[model samples]
Target: MAKAFASQGDMSEKKTSFTEIGEGLYAFTAEGDPNSGVIIGDDSVMIIEAQATPRLAQKVIDCVRSVTDKPISHVVLTHYHAVRVLGASAFGADQIIMSDKARAMVVERGQEDWDSEFQRFPRLFEGHESIPGLTWPTTTFSDSMTVYLGKRKVVIKQIGRAHTAGDSVIWVPDQQTMFTGDIVEYHSACYCGDGHYEDWGATLDAVKAYDPQSIAPGRGDALVGRDMVDAALTNTRDFVDSTYNAVKPVAARGGSLKDAWDAVRDACDPKFRDYAIYEHCLPFNVARAYDEARGIDTPRIWTAQRDLEMWEQLQG
Candidate 1:
């Protein structure tokens, strides 16, 4: 059996850590758990990336209440991943926003993703029964959209495909802060089972263009300064590049999937060994990188059975 890590009970009582990235912007992280951000405006608040369930979201709500009671008027989803969006209903925001492509992905494969993720990582979805259904966005835009919170401007843009086809980032120009959903992870493993390795590099470049002073990633510690921000981006890029390159030659030579996995372990295990979820992410990342290197453009849907099949094939 896989060795169990620390459980949520060990960390649940810990106070939610919120750091001010800019004047009125904060990043809420829970001891390397999935991250959620808050952009406090003059009158209302905009929350980025809801937690996994209403119960878990209540923790975030408590944190928000500690700061301001302006009422969370907007909830923005950087993508349609279950962990990032399933708890959206808890916020009771007037508007739930996402990319137009993200909304389509929700309609197309959201249910499949929900099942796949629940099976893959059971720990994150505490109180899963409370989730009403797949999260649907009340508003969606293609490319970019800018909303004014009173006078504060918050720009949401679909920079490029990285973590998912519909990945997005929220930029607060005044704050020089960016909330990059899963596009950039700090110490946490980059879950690339459904990612686009070829397009991920360019997406990182697009995120860099904003020159964010601070960044709230999907997981791990929030990047608080310029040096930390650069390091996060660079480390994430290295992780993705290594995974892709490790599997490329094997896929190109028509080697078996096992061959690609071996190559990936040899290339990445040493460096990424201590990162969170490294073991869980490696098999899936190698599988997707192998497929993409072999010219598979779209990622295959991951069902529970398919996950086990892939794991058995690669790691058994």
Candidate 2:
């Protein structure tokens, strides 16, 4: 039988875990589901990566309420993906911030992404109807921006691109803890459909410079110790590096996309096959890597229709 398309078979909900990785820092993660980070500053709170919809986001809000009474002042998007940004409205945050590139991506392909991702993972979009259309940023920054919730400092920076063109990571200078959006994943598959594979390695180098004592990645469990953080970073890099290395040569040899996909899947499976979303991400991962290797600098927008078409043409 032919393989199913992206996430069509992944409708079951995984258990959600909310962990405090550091003092005032929380990670709201579901087993393999998209995760969000919470930061409590002096007098206010900031949420990183909103869940998919208002109803779902309310669950995160409830979690926040249980711990801190500080109002959610900002909803920071580490990147522009429907699963990551659409739940912003639910937070009632005064400011919604994203890297300028990420905001631009919303204007360019927000609707298409909303539709594409919803169709791909119906389970994650449980409150789909509650979404108030495409989520927009109240503020945007280029290289980096800092916001203070009272006296605490939250640094947000666009550290190259890995998951998407306009990816950003939140750094807490004093604590030396970082919330690296999709740029760095832990024991979970990295979705490279909208990624910049060649530049991704360099971006990881930037993430390493922060030397975060703890890290809240875009998905999976939070990395709690410096050693664990480093391991996750290295593991993430290896995933991206292996994908590019396996596919780059296939493109260089003018091999078929299938050849590139098979090569990468075969090479990466031994290490990453058990990781979350590995199967769902493989086709898109290979497709994007092949494009990068063949000199396509930018990633193409993935529409719901295109997703299925790509699956049939490649995975099928």
Candidate 3:
């Protein structure tokens, strides 16, 4: 391989921040790493997007303890990615929720994803031994489901497919604050390895329709205020658009995958070079875009070996 995956070399711990996006709503963010959301309810708490491993999850648990002592009654997973759902056990919530599609994905490729991600980003899986196995949802919904945390009304809905086939957003009606999983990222690059580029914009539209005043994004900082929320939404849309747009034309012209990679780099580097995890996500994003443009609807499963082969082909 020409070089290691960017994240593989990023072993230094990131500074974590626990910011309150709304009353009783908090976002635990670790720089560009995946984030976790906390919703403090009258009788219990609901956690959204568990981290990569139980060890990493303990950090989110610590943050939750700081603000409330209410027992964690529920954990809502936005997607089935290993980085997002593998830490569910640490929450030990009575109810673990996910979209039906997400649960299916877990059954289909959960192990492969876990292995692939663990190899791609070692730091995120610091406590891999602690992971009992694939995280399964105790409860699932097809389109939408509403959960009342005591008096706080939280709606979990699958707006559309973007980051993955089954992406859900948690909406707090009282505060108009949404906890968007990977469907929305802040400054962090969207990891499109298993994404649907065509449907991503529509998903963003669905999120935009909600007009969330504040958002606990999948990554980056807690989005507070309409301006900040809007900015992150717009920027996330642009990131997805630019990446797919650059690669689609190349694939349409029957260009090689390498060609698509170069095209995406030329189009996205100048604009997004400073974005978090830009380098780590670029190769996979370009490969997926190329596959999508070539009429491949379902993304191919990514195994640990596939990750290395793809990396070597693009970067070596």
* Top model number, TM-score: 3
Number of the top lDDT candidate: 3
lDDT tens per residue, model 3, 198-228: 9999999999999999999998999999999
* lDDT (Cα, tens digit) per residue for candidate 1, span 69-99: 8989999999988989999999999999999
For residues 63-100, write the lDDT of model 2, one tens digit per residue: 99999998999999998899999989999999999988
When summed lDDT is taken over every stretch of 10 residues in candidate 2, the lowest stretch is 1-10
RMSD of 3: 0.8
Question: Model 1 — which ten-residue stretch has the worst lDDT?
Answer: 2-11
Q: Note the residue pairs that clash in candidate 1.
A: none
Q: Each candidate's lDDT (Cα)?
A: 0.89, 0.90, 0.93
